[model samples]
Target chain A: MAQSSYGTENNNFGPGVAYSQLDAALLVYQEAGGRVSATEPTLDLSIHGADGRVLTGGLVADAVSGATPNGAVPSTVSQNFVTPLKARGSTASVTGASGGSTIIHLPPTPGQLATAALGRQYTVAPNTLPVDKGFRDHRGAITLGWSQPLGAISDVGFGGGFSRETDYQAISANAHIAQNLNSANTTVSLAVNSEFDSSSPFGGIPTPLTVMNAQWKTQASRNKSQLGFVLGVTQILSRRWLTQLNYSFDRQSGYQNDPYRVISVVDPSSGQPTSTLYESRPDNRQSQSVFWDNKLDLDPFVTDLALRYYKDSWGISSKTAELSERINFGTAFYLEPNARWYQQSAANFFHYYLVGGQPNPAFASSDTRLGSFTALTYGAKLGFALNGRSEVYVKGEYYQQTGNGHPADAIGQLRQQNLFAGTKAAMVFLGYSWDFH
Target chain B: MRRPLLIILMAGASISIAGCTAIGPKPWEKDLMARHEMLVDAYPLLIAADEHIYFSKEASSGGRGFAGGGCGCN
Candidate 1:
């Protein structure tokens, strides 16, 4: 037997853990099959490093809000429920299914009736977020790269660094080789990078799809590995302009899901949530991207324009356009304003929520990143040169994301709620860089 | 691994010979091209930070850098 808090308005019961458990099991199976590494595509891959060792580091703070997962808001009472689940670990139980298989009990929605009538049990969902739907984080990272002349016409760069946050950590090593030709007017470069990461989220690792209220097992952390390669060419189109083209490929494998996200299990006909299920995703992904960038210098001002096309094995694709202008205020200071537009197609398994009675899909996630959406970023940077060897800069950006939140075939009350509510985030960065001979 | 390596070899060969046949800036005319602002990646650290933020928040990855890790950003 299981106890359910659905009778109360607190929506205290979270989603199920079995979904996540199954998801984890699937990932294990995928790993047993094989693993791959992934890379990112950027224009800088082929650039020659500064002659001396240059060290760069920054501190970034970000504030994120208005990201309502699946746009599923709890009842007024639950919204006011002051007791955060983070204070206490959820408890759940598993029972033998009809053919000796195991069946897990998951948490019900705000108004769902207790499952005692159906001879089923219920468990709470994982604590994926605070009821307020906002969070803040700080991050810091630093890298040092030095280039050595390989010959009269070639150079090689070696670098490594790490980025750290409260819950995530990554360490990477990279190398690039560049060669000049055509009277030094044209250059070709190749770069490769490998990264490893370990993430330890708060509340440990959530057992996929396990009943949140039920006592399920959890791991303290998970790991991921990535590998990338880039091939690029830079051409001096004229005295005041330059252009570059690059193609990059990357592959990643290991745990790949937000430990705290969940999907609503809704009635097929009514579109009303019956229960909540923790989400899961594939363990391995491979992606590639192509980019083109052009820069034009007009004495005191410079303009940079770029375009990118990206696609991945998960059936996700995206296009990005960016433009920026740097205006010099004498030789000591500069102001650069930048804007970017991005559009992406949803992952194949992206769904607002799974229908309650349908057979669960092999993969499913309510994470908005996997959904179709458009995002815009507007930002500016102010930089000052302290001398020939050092500089300081401050930058800020406002990012907004929006997408189709309502499905045409949505059932009952779901048609009235916005599943794709917009999300906004703001970030600020303070950075310093210097070169040492 | 093999494919990326092959592409690198091919691209290197082509680029090394491209200047021999192409018409563009001369060696002496590349002074401005050597400026940091003219480089595709003018701000490496800032770009790295931005990529990290977007990776944590977005579903798609692999435009500016390789995917590094799976974050529990939610």
Candidate 2:
């Protein structure tokens, strides 16, 4: 068996602290049907995150104890456990989470558990103090698949998946076909994917917190859809080298906004409407990506490279290149180093804050931002093989984006080094896989 | 592929008639164009509108979702 854990705590000035968390998992596969063989399950097709930061005003000066603690209600903690079993006829599984715990011990209250049921809420305050308002939630997804081989050189597969959280729902349909050639040394595959999403807040805003949930209330009732097609070719040059090329075209034409955000600023010059009273931009994007992958086996060492090119509307076209190499000293032991590069062009209408530039009627948005951006990413993966088919893998990465030739007006004064840290979101993933004979 | 090709040709024709199209990169611009990250997006105006719409309607927010208001308290 294998296990891992990762989490982060952020201290905001106005809102209470926030935390992002993820835990470990173990998966076991058993041979059944026509063949009794070990299997490697594909990663779950659907992923979800619903954590939010809390907003507790500030510290309450406890004169008696000399501890400047916030007189706030305690926070509740919830944990989710997910397990999936991939079988031959189709992929099958089970998943769920556990909640209803009062995690805070201090700042006691009569009804602490009920009060912490929701995430934190922020108030309209400036230079405010901080408090403890972190939260954790859960969601799970499952998919079923079927495949059939045509003769000895080709096979087709079809699958469907569904996922749901407290306030959102998602469903997907997928199909693919793989072909073998060159004496079974070369393989080509093509796939099509489609998904639909419906989301809501489940009446998340309290009457007092109406202002906080205004934009969220609108996004709660929206429709989102995505379609993607991929063509892949894999070639084996001799027994020690494997190379692959994949081209994917993804078309997404739906409500592509966060639904829960709004611009509430006034034009500094005249103090007029800087924000158009819930007037945010919509998006219909088309992204074409080409990726090349190679894996070389060198007995104790393995090397892999992945490169991708992506372009979309909104003026944000990008390229990403990545490299990874692994060295396995012995059984149950391995080390790998990886690095990546990414760059992009800002959205066409991206502006910083509204400057006193001449009025151009074509540009309807007063919110000037989303110019251009470039980023550099780097990270590493450390993995070890477990006894039998069970093993664990852990990975972490960092990304930093700066300006390209043209900085969009939407970026505000963030071109400075001071705000670069906020523009970054680091991720760590841990996973385990095994088979039962 | 055939339908998509027809649409592209039609769009190119309309753009030419309107006299409002960008002068595509010349032969010399291929070096820059061939760079992995360089390409044109046909519909950013629509994308911006979509992003604004989604930002107003979702529970979890991020991506390009930060509106002009630094105070997302709203």
Candidate 3:
């Protein structure tokens, strides 16, 4: 998701003084085994007015490159796959090890010998996961927000954002309102958000469940629309504790399938892939979740705890818990250590591979994201205060995911293969924030 | 699921009512609450970045607030 300026319902900068703040950060993320790596740079600026009005703007750029799983299961024998050539007419001959795969030309069809070079093919070695190492993309996004105190309400805000990648574009907007009660000890807030996205894959939108082919698809692009809302409450439990709860609902419709992803159709008895079919997913999804968080101040140390439960119409449910503790070293620096645990059930239609002879399901996908899994994230943040209103911080985190690699109903050769595609990753973030009049 | 949710809601309501009636830091004793580190979202940008990464990797998202914008990362 693109970075957003929404959900700032509790950001009440008491009246009297006006100042502008600037925050800049750079993040580097890498998945284990050279799967995916991303570098992102973000900048945000906010100006506060004496009368409680605030204006904010932000910019973010991302560069991502590395191999990504192609939703295919490993097999005992080497496999070959083909997809539409990215470029139409470049004399780039079949390059060897072109992003971890050897590219080859396909034979001419019928009388189209002259245009036989319209597709690109690659070979994947046996007993190895199929991945598209050629994956690389760059994205840029901008967001703007304005908030101020209304007549009766404590605060009202509006935000909008736009993001663009090589083959994707997204536009989003949100509005929020907050009210303080009980001597400003209890706060209630609500936020509504909407987003529209268009996906124009390099090869076009393929027909779901159809055999994977190299020919370009006719459909140029597809679009999706999302609408969501959140209701939140924050209460000061005591002089040293603050707690918050939020409930959210979201609905999404339209193209929800990954155009480049395919599922293997295997021989029912041999457990060997016979062919691959484009993956499919339900066009509409509805989801709901509840989050609870608490913050406690203990003199020189502070503790934070959060819990969340989520459920979706696709037959997926999840639970999450995160805890963090910050230790202050006088007034100059602080260290925060955090840990998070998460678990989720798989989507109803998730599968490792489809049997060739059995009837096809209405919706099916092999995407590992839809599979059941558990993840753990452990990290720490170190921050140094350069002055009363300026600080520099560095955060490091490690994430690991695990899933059932061996299923009870595993077929032939698949019984010996590890179907789990979860990933391990490391992330580092460096940031600096300063205030100015 | 419904049972747990109901229990939580009731507990939260009870706590809120009790806290409102009994606790009083008065107005001047809010020094601790007024600190920047005490804010609910003190590290807004950092949290946003973390959420962005998780959104791309996980199947579920957006419980704390409205998740704005969309990306094709998943």
Candidate 4:
């Protein structure tokens, strides 16, 4: 929930604002033609399912005689307060009630799918962990830019902005120079840019004691760094079609390890378990990506497609292809159905469960996020252009990862293929865009 | 090693035959493409913001651009 002192007089203030802020707010909103953005900002306080059937997937081979399985109900977490903010011209306009579901995670651990009692399903109530997930309640990003003609088919731009949530915050500014040329009836353009990101690691497991224990222990810490240059292009194939190409390279050189992840190893001679903590790589890592996008106007509707090929030194490589068609049901509304396919090669140090796998002497922790896998993404978004000036768009996406697990992993139960686990996420964005001269 | 070669080849081939890929309003169409919401505008601010969020949280990229920076997220 966000609360605003400037617009307290009126409950919901859009372009219209209080007498003092009215001019500034409207001025900022008009500057870019205008843009408004806001995410879920949920305040759902319903008690999630914690009726005991939610078993903790610890695989202890022995739960204390009286210990009960507990994975469904997230730790004692509930948003007690919320301070949502509304902004214009990169400044806060209103701060709404903030307290709400921030990090909602669905249940079912990777290990629990097998070797567990099946009868528990009926007894387990639907567990809805309130979004006690991230470091902060609200996240917002704003950017303003300008481009001026430098030549027949060329333009230049300079701009910057800052964004932050609870655990992550970034301040970035960039400069780009572009060029375009006429090829018969076709048009081609290219650009080069530079930007940076300063961030901290609070995205993964929240609890240190729990998430990074046993074979796949991992911890996280704050990371601050600079992300360098990129080059891109755009092509206008014809009046009915358009295409674009962009490439970027980034190098994060700083602390690169989970301060919290840990693992247990057994002594060779003595069959006893000894725990070892894993840390980030001592050397800075590198990442590079290449992307291409095309949009074709099929009269009433538009078909858009994008393909990206990416690779990094961390033993991870991937290719992603996505397509979305925006169907206009007239000037009032549009519906977009999207489908995407992604396949990735595992990171060098990644392992399913590290107990009996090849250990990387160079890096301490395995990058589970980059395990070998193929994932399919499907979703839809409905957008309505309201009053010919404002718009509201809502989207829902369901993603499931299916891939072959490396046969050599010690913990075969956690393989990506056999142990199917997925996440469901939906976003509702209320945006107001107006073109002002 | 292989990636660098591919990138080099892509840049070389793209620039050498760059004329063949050209189309439409030339750089003149930038005014419309530069529009705040046009999918592939000359500006990097908004697209950068969106890509930043996507890279950190999700596993997809929506913008048509090249590689980005290195971080310790993985």
* lDDT score for residue A254 of model 3: 91
For candidate 3, lDDT tens digit of each residue in A1-437?
11113443233334556878899999999999889999999999999999889999999999999988888888999988887775543336654456755545655555323455556666788998888777889999999999999998999999999999998999999999999888888887889999999999877888999988776666879999999998888888778898888878899999989888999998888889999999999999888888999989997899999999988889999999999999999877999999999999999999999998899999999888899999999999999987666789999999999999888898998888788888899999999998766
Winner of 2 and 4 under TM-score: 4
What candidate 4 gets wrong by more than 4 Å, as runs, is A1-146, A150-153, A164-169, A183-223, A263-276, A356-360, A404-408, A411-424, B2-53, B57-74
- What ranking emerges by TM-score with the best candidate at the front? 3, 1, 4, 2
TM-score result, candidate 1: 0.71
- Interface C-alpha RMSD per candidate, 1 decimal: 8.4, 16.2, 1.7, 7.1
> What is the clash tally of candidate 1?
32
**Candidate 1 vs candidate 2: which has greater TM-score?**
1
The DockQ-based order of candidates, best leading, equals: 3, 1, 4, 2
- Report the candidate with higher lDDT, 2 versus 4: 4
Q: How displaced is residue A15 in candidate 3, in Å? A: 4.2
CAPRI accuracy category, model 4: acceptable
Expressed as tens digits, the lDDT of each residue in A1-437 for candidate 4 is 12333343332222222211100010001001111112322110111112211111100010001111111111112212111112111232223322222211123237422211111011211222212121223444444444455555345665554555443455555666656445423333444444444444433322322322212112333444645566655666655666766665666665544433333332333312233334335446666777777887775577878887777777667888888887888766888888878787766765333342345345434333445667666777676655433445555555555655335432322222222122223323233332221
* Per-residue lDDT over A1-437 for candidate 2, one digit per residue giving the tens place of the 0 to 100 score: 12212123221211122222122332221211111111112242111112221111111000011111011111121111111112111212224222222222122124322221222233212211111112112334555555556566366777766765444566777788887654445566788888776654333222210122211121235556778777766655434555566666666665543323222233444422223222234446665655666666665676767665555554455556667677777656778777766555555643332333334322222121233445555667677656533457765655455553223332332232121111233444455533222
Query: Model 2 reaches what TM-score against the true structure?
Result: 0.54
DockQ value of candidate 2: 0.03
Q: What's the residue-level lDDT of A129 in candidate 3?
A: 84
Using DockQ, give the best candidate's number. Answer: 3
DockQ of 3: 0.57
TM-score, candidate number 4: 0.59
Listed in order, the DockQ scores are 0.33, 0.03, 0.57, 0.24
